[model samples]
Each structure stands twice: as C-alpha cells, then as structure tokens.
Target: MLTPTPTIEKPSNLVAFAFLLIAFLTGIASSFQLPTLSLFLTQEIQVSPAMVGYFYAINAIIGIGLSQILAKYSDKMIDRRKVILYCCVLAIGGCLVFAFNRNYYWLILLGTTLLGLGSSANPQSFALAREYADNTGKESVMFSTIMRTQISLAWIVGPPLSFSIALNWGFDWMYSIAGLAFLFCGLIAVTLLPKVPRKKMEQNTPLQAPSNNQKSVIYLFITVFMIFNCNGMYLINMPLYIIHELHLPAELAGTLMGTAAGLEIPIMLLGGYLTQYFSKKALIFTALWAGFLFYLGLLFFQNTWQLVLLQFFNAIFIGIIATLGMLYFQDLMPRQAGAATTLFSNAAKLSWLVAGPIAGWLAQFWHYNTVFYVSFLMIAIAMVCLMKVRTVN
Candidate 1:
C-alpha cells in the first residue's frame, strides 16, 4: 500500500494569532484613508473632481512601477524589520504633510504620492505572511484566513472611524491619527517579529529570469488584473452612484456600504474553509458568475434597499473570489513571494488606475448606470477567462 505523505506541522498558533492581530491593525490604519481621501481633496483642498481622480491615478501608476523594485530589494536585505519600520515612518511623513498643508490641490497630490510609496506595505504584508507560513510550515489557508479577516475588519471599522473623524475633527486629524497608527504598528512589528538568519549568496536567487514558467506566471498576472479591475470599478464608482444617482444621503450611503462590507466577513471565513474542499479554479468561476449576476441586478435597482441587497450578495461572491485569487497567485510563484505579491498588488493598482479615470469620464459623459453596465461586461469577460484557465495544481 502507498503511504500518504505527512502534512507539515504548522507553527505555533500564538505566533500566527499575533501576526493576524498586526495584519488587522495595519488594515484598519490603511482603510481609514480610503473612504475619506477623495472627500478631503475636494472639501479641504477645493480641487475639481477631475483633479482628484487624476491624483489617484498618478498614485497608482507610481505604486505599480515601484513596488517590484522595492520588493526585489526587500528580498535581498536581511533587515526586513527595519524595512517595514521605514515604510511606517514614510507613512507618518505623508500623513504629516497632508495634515499641515493648507493648499488643497498641491497637498492632496503630494501627500497621495508619498502615501502611495507607503502603501507598498500592502504587498509587503502578504510577503511577510507567506514567510511566516514557510517558517511555521503552516498551510497557505492560515495566511489567506488572516488576510481576509484583517480586510473584513478594516471594512467594518474603517468607514465609520473615518467618517466620524472627518465629520467632527476635520481631515487633518484623520491623517494625524492614521500616522500614529502606522507608527504603533511598526513599533510592534519591530519588537515582535523573529529574526531569521540570512541565506548565503549561493542560496539566494536572481530577481528575474526568463523561463517557460515565467510566461505562465505572466498569464496569471493578467487574470489577477482583470478581477481587480472589476473590483476597483465597483469600489471607486459605487459610492458616487449611491450618493449622486440614488440621491441617498452620504451617511446612509456609507452605512449601506459598510453593511455590504460587514456581510463579506462571514463569506470570507467560509471561503477559507471551502478552499480546502473545492478546486480554486471552480471557486473563482463560481464567484465570477455570481458577480456578473450581481452587476446585472444593479441595472434593475429601484430603491436604496434594492441596491443594498444586491451589494450584500455581491460582497459575498467578491470575498470568495478575492481570497481564492490571492492563494492561486501565491501557488503560481511559490519561490518569489515578494515578486508574486508585487505582481498581485500591481494588478490592484492597475485596476484603480484604469477605473478612476474611466469611471470619471464615463460618469461625465453618460449616466452612472452605464458604468455598472460596463462592469457587468468586464465581469463576463473575466468569467470566460477564468473558465479557460488550466488548473495550476
């Protein structure tokens, strides 16, 4: 009889739990800016909507191009703790710039670029989680679970926190609080993360090489880009739709969005379990098809409740797709964790880069419904692409 291969024992749950806590805190800090950043630009800086969109697009551009370079460098360096510490410090500086600047447009643009550089932590956190998994011999399930939980917590906490801060204290205080949060997370990471010995030259590999597998990896990146484009379009445009088209109050729009996000948390946790039983490709396909239907539902939405219901359904499917896609990409480039994460992160940035300007232009020329229709078409294309993908495992 053939013997079954023994599963690798995972590292201590205590360490994993601690890492998850850090991930949660990081997510909370990062997310606090997303809902209010554009509003800050418009209200505080008195910039045009077009300019605000442009500023975000530029940030995405910088992040997409620079993340790979930074990740490659990070892989070679021994002092990852120090690297993370510097990212946090950069975030603090960016926040300070935003808090102090009175000229809205210049401050918004400059602050966002600096924030873009700091936001590279998104990928670094993933890379670090993967490293933790490797060191502990834990399954990627643990990593994905931690990530989804952090993201869900951010979605749940960030909007209310941001709105409250922006409503009562002003945008400056929001940035200040975000800066302090980053500093705190950095200090915690510096003290708690275990130091591993650096590998010698022979053990280390070159950052880039052309190979057959590399080409396949590129294809995977394209798929990731498509999925994120679908997501980014929804996130960037939907709020505007709720406030402007639906004629809902800003607070109500935020609440509905928050509710949709809160629903996603359970779906994400369930997704972590489902990945063990189902093929990743199948789960992705299901999510894509479901997302397409959800977009279709948006076309028929007549009231706030209708839109909220659709958003709730959409969130569940999107959560599944997001978690599975992360795992799938990690599986594709097992060795180059940083590079793989950078590629995934850039896909997200690329989506925002494309979505912000395109959505803005579309909203200007046509109706917001047109944007939803376009998103439906994109999700359909994504579903087809996902169906055609060969199972990686």
Candidate 2:
C-alpha cells in the first residue's frame, strides 16, 4: 500500500542523502527563527504580548493564502526543483530582512511578504521527497519518516544553538546564520536533488460531488487542525510562561524543545516501523491522547527536571501526528501529492493563525497556566473528530 509507482531508473542512496541534507539545513533555518521569534518580539523589539500574537497571526494568514496559490500551480510545473529553488531564495531574503531591521512595522511588511512565499518550501520539499520515493520504488511512508527525522536531527542541535547565538551575540547574528543555512540549502537543492517526471494530477482539476475519501479528508483535517492548535499555542506561549510565570531562566525553553525534538526521532522511526502492524488511524488516535496528557502534565510540572521529563510525551504526540497525518492525507488524495501535503501543512498554519491571538489574549488577560488548560480541551475535541472518520483503514 505504501509503494510508489516507479517511472524512471532507480536513484542511488546519494540522492536520498541529498534530501536529508536539505531537510537538515531547512530545519536549522527554522529552528533559529521560529522559537526565537516570540522572545525577539517581546524582549528586544519590545512589542506587547498581544502584538506578538498579531504578528504570528498575520504571518499565518498570509502564509496560508500564498501556499495555497503555490499548491494550485506547482503541480503543473515540469520541474519541482524550480519551485523549491525560488522558495529558498525568498526565504533567504526574508531572513536577511529580519537580521537587519528591528522596526515592528518594517518586519511585518517585508517579513510576512517574503516569508509567506518562503513557507511553501517545507511542503514543496515534502512533495519532492514523496515523488522521488514514488518514482524510484522506495517505501514511501518509511522514506517520508526518514526525511522527517533529518529535521528532528537538525532540531537536536538547532534550538540550543539558536538561543545561545541570540542570547550571546545578538538576534541579528541568529537571523544571519539562519539566512546562510537557507543559502547553502538552496544551492544544494538546485544542484543535486533529482527531478522526477511530472505525473498527471486529476486532483488539480475541478472536483465533482464529495466522495467518502473527500469527507474523511475533511474530518482528518479538522482533527489535525485542532490538535495542532494546542501544540502551536503551547510553542508560542510556553517560553513566556516559564520565564515570567515560573520564574525560570529563558534558555531553559531551548533545552526543553531540543530534548523533545531529540526524542521525536526515535518516536517517529518507531511509528514508521509500526505501520506494518498497526493502522495509522489507531496510532493517530493514541497520539492525540498523548498530546492531551502532555499538556495536562505541563500545568503541574513546572520544575526543571519535570519539564525535561515531560518532553517524552511531547515527542510521542508531535512525532507521530506530524508524520502520520501527512501520510494519511496523501493516501486520501493519492494523485495530488502537492495538494494533500499542502493541506496537511495548512492545518498547522491555520491552527497557528487561531492559536497565536488566543494565546496572547489569555496570557494578557487571565494567566499563563490557562493556556495548558485550553490546550488540553482542544485535543479532547480532536479525539472526538478522529472518532468520526471510521473510513480510515
């Protein structure tokens, strides 16, 4: 079921390695920028918490629109490499702007514009990986999980290094390093990543009446959207929660995230391997519970060691859901890799759009601890939606 339809000569292991490197580089760029952003807005740039929320909300809104535009046309292109190349170039430019400019207005204007275009890089790259595996007769699910682990690998070192650089040298230095990562990644993607021949995509054409598969995809999308809403809210608010509420040092946020990322590698690999024995729906079902428990624990476990220990659950939930959710969408829309993958990624983007403002408002109005309570509630609802999709095998 996971087999890719081969259309060309099988590629060597080196091609796979090339994709892994791209994943690593892109992950590094993301790690440097994403986690550091809240702190940058709050601490250095001196934006209010509500404004910080609006910033991410704006970026997500723009990103969801632009990435949808890309998914519309990217499927028609002859070469996937060109789309990827253009995206990385845009990402580099965005990073450069972040490095130099500290003004809030300037950042929102240029940063959101270029970076929204740049956001397509992740889904596009995933599309490329799926195509390569399909065209070369590799195990698609396993290969996709392997590609994901490369991002996990990058996170293992990326977060701590990111925070260290931002703290020690400056935010400018951090963004500069992220830009360089994209530059190197772009160069490799253009030069070495193999080009798979375009397949006919009926998925891009106008749709008929909704089928069972379409209905299921809608349910799964809502499920993932809610689950990630909790995760996104946590990622956005957890640092501030720890620093201001728990009275812990700021750098500890990096350690917790890095530890969770490290744990995600093994959890993801295990999930990939478990596909042989368990249904993806079953794994996803259990993963949502794990996510709920992680947030529940977060409400109580404010200590250093307890927080570090809790990352295992974070790893279990995030690791499984991220990979399996994407594969599930791909299975539903088999011919439309770009649309399916983008749809999955878009759920996360949409969740962030909602979560950012909510997290900001809650922290500003009520208490930081309330975010965990809301996250717990969101995942419980996600579980209910998951139960609605009985069509999943």
Query: In model 1, where is the ten-residue run with the lowest total lDDT?
Result: 1-10
The digit string of per-residue lDDT tens for model 2 on 1-393 reads 112323343356767887888888888888888878989999878999779877887888888888878876777676777888888889989998898888999888888788888867778888888987887778888999988998889888887789899999998899989888888877877766777866455434543214767777888899999988888888878889999999999989878887888899999999999988898999998798788779889987889999999999999999998898998887876656777888898998899878877887898899877888888778878888887765445
Q: How far is candidate 1 from the true structure (C-alpha RMSD, Å)?
A: 5.6
lDDT tens string, model 1, 1-393?
A: 111211123235645665676677668777888778788878877788777777777767776766677777777776555656667777788889888886755554677667766776656766767766775567776566657677777878887888799889988898899888788767765655544344565138776533545665565667667767777777767777878887877666676667777877777788778877888888777777777778788878758778778876677667776666777766766656667777777776788877776777788898766777887777767766665555775
Off by over 4 Å in 2: 1-10, 42-48, 201-204, 207-210, 240-251, 300-303, 390-393
* Model 1 stretches with alpha carbons more than 4 Å out: 1-11, 103-110, 196-203, 208-210, 243-250, 387-390
Please list the Cα RMSD from the true structure of every candidate, rounded to 1 decimal place: 5.6, 3.9
TM-score of each: 0.88, 0.89
Query: Candidate 2 local accuracy as lDDT?
Result: 0.83
Worst lDDT window (10 residues) for model 2?
A: 1-10
Q: List lDDT for all candidates, in order.
A: 0.71, 0.83
Residue 214, candidate 1: C-alpha displacement in angstroms: 2.7
Q: Which candidate should be chosen as best, given TM-score against the real structure? A: 2
